[model samples]
Target: MRLALLSPLPPDPSRLAHHAAQFRRALNLGGIDVLTPLVGQRPLESLEAARAWVAERDWRGVDVVHAELAPGQRTVYWVLQALARLPHGPALTATVHAPPGLLGQPLHAPFAGVYHARWLPRLTRQASAWLAAPFTRHIDRRLARRLAGVLCTSDASATRLARRLGLPRERITVLPQGLPELACPPLPSGPLKLLCLSGPGQALRPLQDLVAALGQLVAQGGDDLPPWQLTLAGATAASCFEPPRHDPLTRLQADPRLKALGDRIAWQLDPDPQDLPALMAAHHLLVLPERPQPWGLGEAEPGPTAPQGACDLALAVGRPLLVAQQSGQAEQVTSGNGATYTVGDHATLLAVLQDLLTDPDRLSDWATQARRQATSRQWTQMSARYVGFFQQAVARSTRAATK
Candidate 1:
């Protein structure tokens, strides 16, 4: 069926852009005609001009206009707002990525989830966001009601959307990230190659825990513990403005405990996003150190959720996961796939890692399980389900109109 997909064009640095790119790829695989609305010959210079153009568009021909949502993304916000005004427009649908917009923008507390703008001073923006947050949330609630369906990468995000928009659980669908089916590669020899893709935000730091765990492992077992490798990508602080950035790697590297375990854990500084799949495949398991419910200044905000890209990558590459128990990725890490631990608790993560790192057999089992999870959620399979959701929404709307 014909559809108009509203999302940032790819290479824009938001993981959601990459997600939209992947979804577009999946839609193509399913043989669906997709359209992306872009600038015209007149060259719209500002967001206002862009909104005006969108306001005047005739979109009735398409069956669905699938938009992507991240907390406080102005472009997506405007586009969705424009669509919202049209009662006769294509059926509305969206995929909401949990908090931390692609461009590394911080979303404030749940009720007031807005990003820090470069143009606006910090104090002024905070004041404006506080005032506008409720209004934006109101719009979001209305948008949810207008949508035929809402998609979230994790069930946690779905629940958050339901709460924020006051939509029924059924109105939001958990379409966890999907990857193409691939044969499970043979388990690699030697130490478990642990990988993490945590770009340093004060909010999460699995590497520190990894280092702590490493120290414990060495302290208890000396070299007797199972030999394992560690590779962390994007452990650097993402940004320091909204919330201060934390650099766990630099700290861990300095610790006498971590220095003792030299060269055991390798650090990948800003690895190319394009190489992520190959990277995942090369590793044994992916680690997520985020809390399930994100916090702001020690107080929890129930607004937007955290990112679950590691879950999708793990699924895609058949790598087991070591995710935080509270993080949304926890849902993807079943008993067989990986272990989960409370994010801030160092001992639990230490013990869990010790078990798998020491025993090759368990690691192999989890790898097999990871591949199974990936196999079950392949894009070829999921894309069909995704398309069907849109079709079903359109069909239902059409039926309601006839009645």
Candidate 2:
């Protein structure tokens, strides 16, 4: 079947880009015909141009149009607008990454509002008009009514969206993001190194708290504590709470204990994907301290779902993961052979770090289990699940058309 994979192409760090790349790779491996639009610089603008581009192309043979949703409030609206204009729109399927309620709030809320409160004055004003527009809810409801099928990266994301859109659970499929398989080297014997990978935004507050807790641990434990290093990767210096660019190592440098361990704490800025597997294998543990935002004022804080590419990459490399209890991916980490700590609980984080440092054998055992769990959830498998959903969506649309 010819499938037109609709999504923004590279140079951007969007989840859609990652998914598109993975899906294309998997579909090719499965010997499927996939056609992607020619993406240029400035992808969002390019998406608008795609409608006209697809119209002129030969889409008669295309069986389906699988559009990956962008991470924004007006994603559904944009998709709907594109679909309405397509001359030969095939049966449509969409993947929604963020939860539905997220569309109602300010787009900058999770991106800039939380961490970079200093930038809020300007950023909020810039994004306010877009956030105030009420058209998103209308578009969301319309997409729910029209879409042939929906996909989410996590079960919790799917369930929440299913309820919000008032769609049946069976109509929404949960397909976790796939991680590239990697060969893990033997566990390092020296100081334990922990890696934190996250976007540069308010979402990194949990990571800051964890680092502060680690400093406290170093001061309190002194000689009794095992030698360890915390490597902060994929985040910028601006996001650090401390002024003058608070990269992880810089923040911890104030503590006498941490200051003594020179070259141990490192900050890697935008390392290549090829370097990640080796980095993950070198680290004794991976920590993601992502705290969830309040879901609708009435609901209690929810538990974490599963980790995406970063955590999964660590898992594939046989590294034990440490995530916040409130992270959406916390349950996945704990269940899939990793450890968890209560949100903002530095003592618990420190204790876990210390334990892993002291007992190398235990760390190795967790790593083995983590690798085993990660291998079973490969991108090839995820693509197959997506293809099945696409087939079902086509069948359903055909039935509806006949009726």
Candidate 3:
């Protein structure tokens, strides 16, 4: 059977795009023909063109027209929705790759009409975000319904999508994000090398708080303790230091906290996304110290969902996690795998670090378990599962059509 995938290739560096590419390769390797039109950077333009592309050939001959829905993938969603309404339309499915926090409790509902008016879009984006949210959801429900299963990357996400989008919980499949085939590096021999991955925007305040907590640890270090190094990536390096201690707002080239900690803090300036897996493997732990949840009350987003990419890489590379309790990223974590600390709680972070550093045995144990988790969710296995899910989706769709 043939599947036509509506998703992006590489160089875009989105989590959804990365997984789409992974599934394509795995399915092809497993003997399924995956066809994708040559859609480049301008996806909306390409999506509009796909109508003609399909009309010229056999769009109906395709078994499944699968699309992954991201903010960037909206145009493709519209196109697929339009296509599903045609006579003898092909079966279509979608993978909801958006984080649950954004989907579950949308801040966009407040900004409903603001999205369309170009000038208004710049003002109250809440209206626009609300307006843009349910693009073809109603149609998607009727067309694909049970047959066109909505794929979610996590169980928590699937649950949220069901509750928020009002879709059937049974119809949503939990297909976690896939990682590139990567080998878990050996455990650290020296100080704990902690890598802090910053979120999409200037979400570094929590990291700064953790650093300050570490500073407090250093100050209280009249007692001997194991040392740790923090390497941050994603956003520009900034200090969350207090006014008297350091500049509060500006990003200093050389943070004094680094000096206070004997220069242990470092950051990556927009590292290439392709290099991330290797970077994740290099570090011993991946920490996403995201802010608290229920975002959009005149503060940084609470990061309602887990830091999926960060958590995925850490698990894939066998590096244990040190995530915030507020993030959904901490969902599957256990005392055996890694630790979760409260956001901005430097003392908790300090205590967790002190315990891990002192007890290397526990640290090593967590890493081992992390690798096992990674092995279970390997791309090869995930792709096989996707193929199964697709077949099921097609049969359901075919049966529904017959009825």
What tens digits encode model 2's per-residue C-alpha lDDT throughout 242-350?
Answer: 3322244334336555455456567765566568778777777888777544322111111111135567677666777887766677756655577888867777877
Count of backbone collisions in candidate 1: 6
Give the Å error, residue 93, model 3.
1.1
Instruction: Give per-residue CA lDDT, model 1, range 1-403, as digits (tens).
Output: 8888877656565555656777887887787898987412243433465568777777767888888765434566567667766767777787776432211132334323323444445465456555665665665676577777787776676777777788888877777677756656766666678877665443534556667777777788786776778786653444333433455555555767666777886777656656777777888877777654333322222211123555676677788888877566677875488888886687888787888866777878888888778787887777787877888778866765567
For candidate 3, the clash count comes to 10
Q: Could you tell which candidate, 1 or 3, scores higher by lDDT?
A: 1
User: What does candidate 3's lDDT look like per residue over 1-403, in tens digits?
Assistant: 7998887767765545566788898888667799876356354444446466456566766888888665545456556756765667767788765544222212223342244333442336554554555753444445444336778776777887777656778888886677656888888677888887663333446656777877887777634877778786663323222111222123433557756766477666467667888888778888877642332322223221226556777787778888887667666576368888887777788888878768888888888888887887788877788888888888878877898
Model 1 ranges off by over 4 Å: 10-14, 39-55, 71-73, 99-124, 180-184, 202-206, 235-244, 292-307, 344-347, 400-403
lDDT score, residue 311, model 2? Answer: 70
- Specify the poorest-scoring 10-residue window by lDDT in model 2: 297-306
The candidate maximizing lDDT is: 1
Off by over 4 Å in 3: 10-16, 38-57, 99-121, 131-147, 219-221, 237-259, 270-275, 291-306, 332-336, 345-347
Of candidate 1, the 10-residue stretch with the lowest lDDT total is 297-306
Compare the candidates by TM-score and give the number of the best one. 1
Q: Compute each candidate's TM-score over C-alphas.
A: 0.80, 0.74, 0.78
lDDT of candidate 1 at residue 187, scale 0 to 100: 61
